[model samples]
Target chain A: MEFLSYLISGISLGSVYAIIALGYTMVYGIAKMLNFAHGDVIMIGGYISFCAMSYLNFPGWLALILAMVVCTALGVVIEGLAYRPLREATSLAVLITAIGVSYFLQNSALLIWGATPKVFSPIVEGTQNIGGLSVSNISLLTMAACIVIMVVLTLFTSKTKMGKAMRACSEDKGAAQLMGINVNRTISTTFAIGSALAAVAGVLMCSAYPTLMPTTGSMPGIKAFTAAVFGGIGSIPGAFLGGILLGIIEALAKAYLSTQLSNSIVFAVLIIVLLVRPAGLLGKYVPEKV
Target chain B: MLKVNDINVYYGSIHAIKGVSFEVHQGEVVTLIGANGAGKSTILQTVSGLLRSKTGSVEFLGENLGNVAPHKIVAKGLAHVPEGRRVFLQMTVEENLEMGAFTRPGSEVDSGIADVYKRFPRLEERRRQIAGTLSGGEQQMLAMGRALMSKPQLLMLDEPSMGLAPLLVEQIFEIIKELHKAGTTILLVEQNAQMALSVADRGYVLETGKIVTTGTGAELLNDDAVKKAYLGA
Candidate 1:
């Protein structure tokens, strides 16, 4: 019974990681650069929701939506201001700039939200009995939300025109531009979508843990990034699979192994997987054309 | 329909194109032919707004294309089929064609794709297959068919016969002739002087980024200098 409960919670936590990983994966896919600041965007999302709910006395759904909206705008602005200018620059330069942006966001959040942490009320409370196994409502809700998002995202990328444009840009930016697709706009839209997902992750993660702080998103952001790399950095389904597996591993390790070593164990497993399959589980290995 | 005046382009310290000037009138099939590193592709790229000329201007359809984005250049009825057949390899053949109509109306995309499919029946046959899986000749055909989906008034083909079998090269030239007959103005850049000159209405011979000779296709094809230098006589 305890194992079942831990597994469900693990899935819930995995769902949060999956959401964050989606942000990382999508941005990297289209822009071909890691937005190291993605973790901070989640912190902003959590802060936005916390303010909306407690300070503004808004409903939970409204807070989520507001957070998503704010995060989307923030993502676009960050891409335009920080990443766009570096478009023609080297990968090392861009990577360094991303780290700078990450620090900027972290510090700004520190100035605005201060160092104190806030407790959160679960967005969906209570328990649900499933086949004689008890699952918390938040766990069920998180898992359900992840499934819905995965389905919608898959369809959006496969069926919609904008989605197709995104895929084209990822494949070849110069060719996509030649095809009359606006490469800049496609990249901007990707950042918008990614940050919106981060916002949802922020809210759900805070709900499960019931604590909100400026640094709340940093740790999970790193975990989800690992998950993204674990499953194949640019593959959507890979992010989800990696996140779920990561969550399960963490949960199981904490339950069975020493709690002090669970985080280390998670990272050690990632190193092993990468050594075995360097491109992650589903990453495509393309040879350089001479 | 297009004019490039006194253009100078540099790649870092290397002066790739030096004060080159050219123009293409409506309904004319113009060809730029040269040996490797003669700046034929550079001229096409500059005209398509991919590269900026430090000096001089490009006028297309009466509007000066001053720093217009490449996609906007396509929107203005100029489609460039770049060298090396840079097709979206992961996309299906049909999707690549659909992408070509990205600047057009959504309602007209189907018609545009239908027209391309009609022109290249091989593309229609492998419409559902990934572009990377296609043979070199098939990918080249797919690239040209995709550009046609844009329904541009002027089509710029950069080395259409590049890396293809001799038979495929003949077939591609035949299609170019057919497209010319269908009233699409063309700017062809090629190292295959014989094939390019055969289809060109007018030809410009570029040597080290300068126009060394200019004449009718037949005139250049028969010129002793052109024959000696490029025709490998």
Candidate 2:
């Protein structure tokens, strides 16, 4: 019974990581650049929702939507201002710029919100008992939200015309342009979708953990990145699977072994998986033909 | 009609195309036959807006294409089936065709796809299969079918027979002839001088980024210099 409880909570935690990992994977897949500041976007989302709900007395649902909109716009602006200029630069240079943007976001949050951690009220209150297992409403909601977003995203990518264009751009930017698909506009849309997912993850994470700080996104961001690499950086289903697997391993390690070693165990699993399959579980190896 | 006048293109420090000029009038199959590194692909790229010519003018249908973006160039009724086929490897044949009609109206896309299917029944058979899984000849067919989906008035083919069996090469040229008969203006670049000269109405011989000779297909096919340099006979 205790193991079942731990597994449930672990899945809930994994759902949050999956949501965030989706953003990272999608951006990496389409633009071929990792947005290191993605985690900071989550922190910003949480802060915005907190301020709106507490200070401005906005309703819970309205606050969530506001955070999503702000984060989406911020994502597009960041791509235009920071990443666009470096599109032709070396990947190392773009990566350094991403790290710089990440630090800048963290510093700005600190200046505005201070070092003190803020408490977040649960968006969904109470608990439900199912088959002798007591599940918090927030936990169930987090899982449901993750599943819903996944379905919608899958449908959007596979069915819509814009989605086809995005896939084409990811495959070959030059060919996509030849086909009359606007490469710049497609990349911008990818960033917008990624940042909005970060907002969703941020709100769910704060509700589950009930704490907010400038550095709150850092650990989750790293974990979600690990998840992306574990599942396959460019594969959507890979991100989802990698997040859950990492979460379960961490939870089990904390429960059975030392809690202090849980972080180490998570990374150990990544190294082992990478050794076996360098491209991640679902990633296909593409060779350059002469 | 498409006209390229005195176009000089540079790749950084290397002068790739130097003062190259050519004209393709409406409803004509024009072939540019050259040895490798003679700037055949560069000329096609410049006309497609992939590579900008530092000094020269490209006029397509009476409009200057000097500053048009690559995607906008497609909207102007010109389509480039780039070298290497460059098909969306991971996408299906049908999806590849859909992408070809990306600039067309949504309502017209289905019919465009249907037209491509009718042209290449092989594509219809493997429409659901990933493009990378298709054989080289099938991929070439898919690439041409994809370009046709755009309803292009002028279609540019860059080395459609780059690496194929001799029989497949013959079949591909036959299709090109068929397309020309169907009223599609074609700009063909090929290293296979014999086949290209046979099907083309007009021919230009390129040597070291310059048009060394221009004539009717029969005139160039029988030219003493062209036969010695390009044709084995």
Off by over 4 Å in 2: A286-290
Tens digit per residue, CA lDDT, model 1, B165-189: 8999999999999999999999999
Q: Which 10 consecutive positions of candidate 1 chain A have the poorest summed lDDT?
A: A281-290
**Residue pairs in clash, model 2:** none
Give the whole-model CA lDDT for all candidates, comma-separated: 0.91, 0.92
Question: Using lDDT as the measure, which candidate wins?
Answer: 2
DockQ for every prediction shown? 0.59, 0.64
Candidate 1: misplaced stretches above 4 Å? Answer: A286-290
DockQ of 2: 0.64
- Report the C-alpha displacement of residue B196, candidate 2, in angstroms: 1.3
lDDT of 1 by residue, A78-167 (tens): 999999999999999999998898889888988988888888876678898998998888888889888888888889888889999999
